[model samples]
Target chain A: MNRQHIWAVLLRNLYLVRRSQYRAFSLFYWATVELFLWGFVTLWLQDISTPDVKITLVATVIGALVFWDLFFRVQQSLTLAFLEDVWSRNMLNVFASPLRPRELVAGYILLSLLFGFISFVFVLVLAFFLYALHIWSLGYYILPFVVNLLFFGWALGFVILGFTIRYGPSVEILAWSLPVLVQPLSAVFYPVSILPPLLQKAAFFIPTMHLFEGMRAVVLEGRFDVGHVVWASLLNVAYFALAIVFFYWMLSLARRRGLLSRLVMD
Target chain B: MQESRLPGSVGIPPILKVTDLAKSYKHLTVVDRISFQVEEGEVVGLLGPNGAGKTTTIHMLLSLVKPSGGSIQIFGQELAKDREGILARMNFAAGYAALPYNLSVYENLNIFSLLYGIPDRRAKIEQLLQEFQLTRFRKQRTGALSSGEQTRVGLAKAFLNDPKLLLLDEPTASLDPSIARDLRALVRNKMRAVQGAILWTSHNMQEIERVCDRIIILKQGRIVAQGTLEQLRRQFEQDDLEEIFVALMALPEPAMEQTERPR
Candidate 1:
């Protein structure tokens, strides 16, 4: 389709999220709870450590929260996306349209990233007043973080999308839980090296580990870890490419088997 | 392909043409060796029982499902290769299918307008809202609308860009009789006015006879009879279309029992 069509599709999705207050309310509640839960930990640590150590600890925590929200919440976002179509049975209309499978996927991931950006901005603004913790050079680092987050989230979101498309709605619970389960494995709450050797090696395979590391290094220490950023970016690209291939292949198979129209039946 | 001498046979290509189309699941053929061509400005009914592969055939036409064996050309272009081109000129609607409910009726229609890349979307949407009698519910959520209203919205969304090929599945499934009649008339008028073709699926034989120029009766994934209502009636030794439909859906064992009774 043309550029105007793509923009209309994109804007329409955003408007839906805005009108329903579903995504916005989700972000608000999630951010508020995280702020209080993490805020307590920051306070507890400050009582035990010197001012410099406390500052470092808080910065890492904030960086970790950003990565956590992006990686772990991605599946939730995808579930929201797929569920809307399934619950309303509107998927048939979309599948009937001329929009390419790739275009629909791109539109969805872009929406997810857009929502992620909103959450990031909302938390940042609320954190300023709630915690008084200043994130140094945030303006410079935000764009890169978002770019990385988009790739990473879409890569993770695709696996869930594939499952939903193939196995149907029963797997949605697993889809939501996957993100939360991957949090610790992704090194969002701690360093990858701190895990068991086997787990640490396994963590290296996840795209988010490198992202959280790069984010923590840059935002917390004012040190941009170029090697980590490059590695993370490459890993995300590879994962996203693999997801695209997987989805298209499944779609072709589904079409050949005439299972695509049976999407609602299953 | 042989070109038939129908009216408006000038430059307009057939809306849909399929050759040796086939689809099977687990070695069981659902749509086997089906071949049909729908000309522009024609409405064809796909009539069959529950598992007779009507939906499967439509899916193949829409490219929602790929053919196991043959070719599908929409507007004279292969669907697999010219998907976007073919799809942009087509639209589909069904009662069981709903638009994105989280979106308002207006936003839902607007999104589809955008998806189809219709120019002057606002004016077009307004015209559709008034035409579909959905003007008052423009800003209301789609989920809140009754099933009949939702189907109307679906229809409005489908025809928003005046698709050249429209695939409708039970277009009047859950609507009241009055609304159903209205929709049927609207579809007929639109098809006549706009050089479009419709592939409609329904069990309503009266509606079929009233609206369809041709009908394809499918049984067990194969075409049992296909022609205009008059042609099918004479060929089947039936006075009406309903008898032919019953004979197609009828079981063989009961006839054996009745014959064996020898009353």
Candidate 2:
């Protein structure tokens, strides 16, 4: 991969965000709103519960929201960065350059990492200041869970990218909706045990499901489960590989069908 | 009439060699076995009506649209295998394709220069801005610029790499006559200086006559005629290039198809 080409794509998107106040503000908008909304819910739940369970309620709920937002934001960062080129009718110029497909993908992934980490930290700080919820209390276990969530988010991001490339912007709703559609299956707000038996079985295939389950194990039982991390990592490996294949397949199909040109013209 | 340099006259291969290139979607054929060449220091105008496959041809050359049959060799490498390597030495500009609207003119050029891997990006950008008369507007957002100014910025970005092969698609369609003339002169000077090749597409016959060393006219995705102005004039018995273009465009489909095949 050409580092210069990758850096060029990343720099191009960064310049867009840097120049526009609305776009810059959007980076933190949803994360902050979700933190506040869920922070209040954590407080209300704590007030109603007995003192013993109150702390558990705060950490579990707030941590889930924070971690879930990481996944969502990373996915959005990638899809939005790509759509920026499409919306500007700049795809032709971009693809016409020496930037390889892999390099372009690398650029989007790096953009997602940059934006995702920034929003993750912003929301973490906001949760601390507003609700006194300490995510760091989850200990070193938080690191693996965070990495697993990022992998799953990237997997989902690539899937959405493939769909957008295949169907054009008409299906951009999938970018916003697909992650939400996977939310229930992921059991972001609840344990897999609370899900129906059928969904529980289906959720086993979702890396986020394994990740959140592991996060709850640490928060509630103080048990750092290595098995959850292993399962999530293995599943992430499969899903991420599949996503990359799907993405390249869709790109080749788009080129053969002249969909790339259509997307530019449209 | 301009003198046409035959390919390989200087013992150098053509910069672009497209052989029997074809693209079809399902049952519909868009580009039908078209073959052409553009030599170094030459400007070849690609003329055709709307949907006559000019844009598709350009897209195929860029590898944005995959060709169903045939090959494209650029800089002595096959485009299918070394797309990135080939594209590094090529650049394209179009009236319809735009830079990111939110970025300033300078930023847009800077980003493209980086994409092209230009070694002296800042210097090249500054020079291109002055060359395109866009120095004062460097800080202005590309979207806020007037259409004509935007076209100039696009041209400047196209030159960022000092590309060996430049593909221009109706580049001056939005420019005023004076600006268009200046752009033609600038392109000619650049070509002469660098020994580069350009495959240009323009509906404006006068501009083509002024800039193009040879003309390839397409009708319904087939090359109906191709030659220097004098040769084309003599073949069609028409003095004006525009008149030749109109007569070729006015031909019925049957006659145009017949022209594509040997009589």
Candidate 3:
């Protein structure tokens, strides 16, 4: 929990983003393209639908997309930060320092918060300027939804990190694809009701599913559902706890197997 | 040939102490029950063939690899319990373990200084840059630098916190001979200035002969021989370290067993 060490890990990754154009582009590129692609799709939906359906469509679809991106970006930030060290063969340098594993994680979490918030705001502004959509219009419930999505994102991030550490860089595809694997189960684009009954039962365990369901309730029904928030929070608590345990377990196993050094050295 | 004081000669604990340290993966023992010490103001070269466990030994010492048996105590504290605190007073550099390539030399050093929590980071970094003759390359990306320059930056980063114990693993492996010689001199000078302990690993017998105050040679995960350069040369009946190393490698396992000397 040394702040200086945590700041160092965070600052090192920040310097990487600040220096490399490709890294900077990758951070914001997909999020921006998603925003624009969905922005126009919502515009087209607005033109086709009646005025009554039009207002809800933009807020529902675009807002969901923005919030989903928040979760994805946060998770990606964590994995990518770690992968940066691995790719540079700098993991030995990092782990050999005074910085603890938890401190390195804290740094990645901070980077996620920074990147997530920036991209969130960036897309929000774009949505506002292009389509006159206001996410804050969803009201104070946005707070809980954002918080739940972020926690779930971090939970998924830890799992991804755990896998990467255990298996090495060969399985890096999981970083890009794991969140997507969770997407359908999360019910990000639609209601859990639309999912098969079996998946709906499975989705109940996913905190993001409840948060997305909760977001729809706020946007469409104008209903403030405390139960959704409570369920999401409880589920997030369990998932996040398990995720941290998994991450540390993998790290301990890696040390025992000499995988940490082998990952960089090989 | 420098004669070295034995560990604990003056009642001060060696900066690094390992007793029966061992690491095994499944059925393979990479580092056998090997024990050694590096006292303050000493440079001990860990020399072995490619798979003789030098890197694994270094990894275990760093706690990057957990030993299956035995203990590592640094600065009189157990490494497992005080890894962060112990590592704060230690640093490592390897040619294969590089600084972030995309970052500039100054940025890399600055970030490492922060990691080590060095006060007066700017002054320390500037001094290292000047000392390593890397001032002109400060703003250049580390990846763009020559192999020798990159090794210098790596060395500068290693010295960032003025670690009490420094572990160098083939740091100049890729550099040209002249650059390697210069780096060897630089490291020796720096260690002397700080009166720090070093556990160095290299295949270059010449480099080890030039830089190491003492040498510990590992063969197949066991310490085959250890003493000053003069002692090893005498024991192996060779004039130069290269010949000594060649003779050691050529011996059968049973013959190698005969050469084992207690530290």
Candidate 4:
């Protein structure tokens, strides 16, 4: 729990990203491109849509892309944090030092937050200056949605981390694919009503649905639904709690089995 | 921290104590109940064949793998309870395990220095860079360096914190004979300065003979023999350490079943 140790992990990772342009650029390349592609398409759609629905059409499309990117980033920041050491075969070295497992988690948590903020700013700027869709126009209500999305991402991050630490980099594909699996279920780019009935039923367990639904409520209906926000926030807490519990449980199992360093050799 | 052991058995405590350390994967036991100690200011060589459990032993000591049985203590503190405190004063460098390849020699060392909370960080890094003869390559990416040079950097990082106990697995494996000898000398210098011990594993019997204070030879998954070079030679009636090793390996399973725990 030493702050110095936590900062050490953070600083070391920052140094890793700083030394490699590919590493640094990859952080924003996909986020920026997604925004540009989607932003332009949404902006063009404003003309085809009826005048009454044009604003709603533009807001939801662009907002959905931005928010989805945020959720996607939660996975990247954490998996990268863990994988960076694995790629270098540096896990044995780091874990051998006095650095605690929790410190590693804390450090990556901070890294994810920084990355999330950076991507948020990058998408907002790209969305605004390149296309006229302003995220700020969604107003103060987006704040709660942002927070909820972050925890959902964190929850997913922890689950992937648990699997990775126990099984090795073999499960890395899960880190990327899990979020996309949630795409149709959470209805990222579409409303839950558009989902098949079975998926809509399953979407109840996904907190992202409420957050997205709540976002559309703010933009399309000009209605601030406390029920949706409260539901999303509560589900976020529960999912994240399960994630943390899974993390510690897997951590101890890894320790007991001596899978910690060997798991990351690849 | 036992007063009785401190006063009579040895003045300085054993840097590392692995008691009945064993690890198994359900049906196969990788490390069978092996026990050993490394005293302060000593270098103990851990030698075994390919599947002799050398890596597994190192992994268990670092808590990278959990043991099915036994305990590990460093600096008179159990690793289970004091992993962080024990590890802070310990470092590991292996010829096979690499530093961050993309990181410069200096940056890699800097990361370690901070993690260990080493005081006077800049000076310590500069000292290690110059000492390891890596000053010229301080800014070079670790991956870009020659294997010999990378080994030097790995050792340099391990020494950055002035650790009390260092685990070096085939640290001289990748280097040429001369560079390996120089690296061995560097390790000796650190051992003297820090009053530290090292658990070293290597295949080079000559190098082990020259660099180590004692040796533990493992076979299958257990320690078959251990002692200083001279003592081991006397025990086996062999003139050379490698000959002793050859003879020990040739031992029948039933004979080696009775492991000689060399103090």
Of candidates 2 and 1, the better by lDDT: 2
Candidate with better DockQ, 3 vs 4: 3
Candidate RMSDs in Å, in order, are 5.1, 2.1, 1.9, 3.7
Question: Candidate 4: where are CA atoms >4 Å away?
Answer: B1-10
lDDT tens digits, residues B104-211, model 4?
999889888888999898999999889999999999899999999999999988987888889999998878999888888878887677788889999998888888
lDDT of 1 by residue, A171-226 (tens): 77766677767677778757778999999888887777877777677765777777
Among residues 3 or more apart in sequence or in different chains, the pairs in candidate 3 whose N, CA or C atoms overlap within 3 Å are none
Q: Give the per-residue lDDT of model 2 (tens digit) for B69-126.
A: 9999998889999998889898999998999888999999988898889999999999
TM-scores of chain B alone in all candidate structures, in the order given: 0.90, 0.94, 0.95, 0.94
TM-score of chain A of each: 0.89, 0.97, 0.96, 0.95
- The 10 consecutive residues of candidate 4 chain B with the worst lDDT sum are B1-10
Give the candidate order by descending lDDT: 3, 2, 4, 1
Instruction: Tell me how far the alpha carbon of residue B195 in candidate 1 is from the true structure, in angstroms, after superposition.
Output: 2.8
What is every candidate's C-alpha DockQ against the true complex, given to 2 decimals? Answer: 0.64, 0.87, 0.87, 0.69
lDDT of 2 at B104: 98
**Better TM-score candidate (3, 4):** 3
Over B4-80, each residue of candidate 1 has an lDDT whose tens digit, in order, gives: 21233446667788887888877698887778878898788889888988888887777888777889998888999
Give the worst 10-residue stretch by lDDT in candidate 1 chain A.
Answer: A70-79
Q: Can you write out model 4's per-residue Cα lDDT over A124-156, one digit (the tens) per residue?
A: 777777766777766888889888988898889
